[model samples]
Target: LQKLRSGQDFNSSHQYPQLLPRRHCGKGLIDGEKSTPSATLYEFPWIAKLFNRALGYNCLGTLISHRYILTSENCINFYFIPDLIVLGEYDNFREPDCQLEDPTDCAPPLRLYEVEYVVRNHNDYRYRIDLIRTTENVAFEDHIQPVCLPLTSELKHFRPSQYTIAGWNKNSKNTTGIIQKETIYAASSAECQINEEHLPHNVLLYTTSHENVANRTYSGGPVGAIVPSSERRFVQFALVISPVERCVVALDIVPYIDWIRANMVE
Candidate 1:
């Protein structure tokens, strides 16, 4: 908390060289996911890709700690198969993307970390909560970092507003390491029920625009509010449970802060 408030380094050094933005130009591996048209380096440093080792389904997740991953319980409830996570990857087709001549260029190495533990809150179909721990500490880099789990006081100020989210592209039939994102607005309970059929009180909506993304399988993607008065940092507010054409329903994270804090490793 002190490090976040002070803008100081927490678990790792908090500085990096300049990064250049690159546009994406590729189809996804399935019918739903598609690569982003334009992506910037270090833009979304905390998004993780969850891949089912046994089958071919993939979900998005958020790194809240060096070893803890927060995602939707529904993503893992159907099958108890193992999941591997890919972090800090941009182009799904390429690996070790060396944009600059210098090896010191700030791109992170491609990695696939295995899950070692799992916890799901299944009090109801509404919970939609899941917490996963990596087999080992994830290597931090410029393009890969953990997102902040805001203090309860900070989350309380989260007004219904614009937010950003990231997910894997499954539109194409080829497997890639790309992670795409979109801009959506937080909707009220009334608005949520309007777009989605039936959602519990613990869920909210993030609606899309006309030039919106083709909503595919983006479950477990991080839905975060850009700090209303803070710097270029974002604090996670929810986790996606379902993504549709014009709207995405996410489980609120604010209500589970204590549960998360107790399980996370420093």
Candidate 2:
């Protein structure tokens, strides 16, 4: 709490040792069993891993504020508090640490939190709108920062025509242990429906190969784009709501921008 409130230098200040930025993040799997670390891997620091108490990592969420975590409603319920929220986590195989010096030695140091509440949407049950708050305040760093919610101007001018979806796999026959990235091409709303055939109302679609293994864990994950025209770096355009054989369905952020701004921690 002191480091979070004191605003110490994240990389250099040892007095606030807990605020140091992580050195490295993760490698991406091209197919199923290779490690390819990206130089721009840390671009999406706001992505979070939601781990259930009884189960392991359940889905992905976004760290929108120091106190609040945004995730899908279907991912969590009102009855239970999640076990932990891991921020800046890359490979699930490595033990989550916050101060590891070597990337090969371990995954970067992870900022973890205890769940405080599960805020649900009152209007639509399937919308899976939830605000999971932490018991304590979060300390932001180079490796851990909130993603900017898309504003009207930002979305209209900067949204990408293509984006990437990221997910993880453990190691072994059941898993491979590194994060996987898949490129999804943007489609018109009508074309999205025609392609997928079952894209729910109010949802957007991105193109997929239907053969990528990464698509399996893509549900409840992030789809971010590096908008070239606007010169905007990776801005998360949507959350993976559902995955079909040909296309992936995501909730359109345009309609919910007002709702997000209102409910998020200011």
Candidate 3:
């Protein structure tokens, strides 16, 4: 329920105080069970589904603040902006999705918000960043919260061994309505530039064990890693801005921390 204001000293550590620890980051309803192809009912609470009833287009987004949703440039390429963004959703077909172990333990219903406006970083050519402003500020709770952004320069450049990508695999024939998460291997920016000369230098390059792990449907989804600190909160490193053929390209969040903050407060 906190609002990010202008002229405040930016610090990633204190930005999102609602973020849970590493042990509860992606844990499902069950104490020890894990959500595989189907992410636990509330495993990734920041994930949002963008949709336009007129166009019938769907894309994944990350809830970055009480009123803003971060997505990719391609997600807003349509003629009209997405009219709706759904949060805290597990399965599209189920209402109050429950755990497999005990059906009685269920998650809260999905939160739907109407899109008020859209903002795109036109200057960012390498990996474009986009933000969707909701009509009202969100109420943060157990099943709804914002993901941490790389507010400091150190976090942006810090590369880990692996990154996590989560989205609704609606485009895949093998996958169902459940949210899916996969580990993508991080490739050095230098190596990525050498392999893909067309890509700009500001992006984070990644290679998946399977090419189909991240496709067009994952556009605007979050590419994050568990911050290696006492807090151990999940920090969104980038957005799935482009398509995945051989190398997956993303808009690195480190470079756009200032832009994101300005937009959030404005």
Off by over 4 Å in 2: 1-43, 78-81, 95-108, 156-158, 170-175, 188-199, 213-215, 229-231
lDDT of 1 by residue, 191-237 (tens): 54463456678887778772434435468877875554424456777
**Weakest 10 consecutive residues, lDDT, candidate 1?**
20-29
C-alpha RMSD for every candidate? 10.3, 9.5, 5.6
Error of 3 at 80 (Å): 3.8
| Model 2 C-alpha lDDT per residue in residues 229-249, reported as the tens digit of each score | 332445566787766666777
Better of 1 and 3 by TM-score: 3
Question: Against the true structure, what is each candidate's TM-score?
Answer: 0.74, 0.71, 0.81
The full ranking of all candidates by lDDT, starting with the best, is 3, 1, 2
Judged by lDDT relative to the true structure, which candidate is superior, 1 or 2? 1
Predictions in order: lDDT: 0.63, 0.58, 0.70
lDDT of 1: 0.63
Point out where model 1 deviates above 4 Å.
1-37, 78-80, 98-106, 173-178, 188-197, 210-215, 228-230
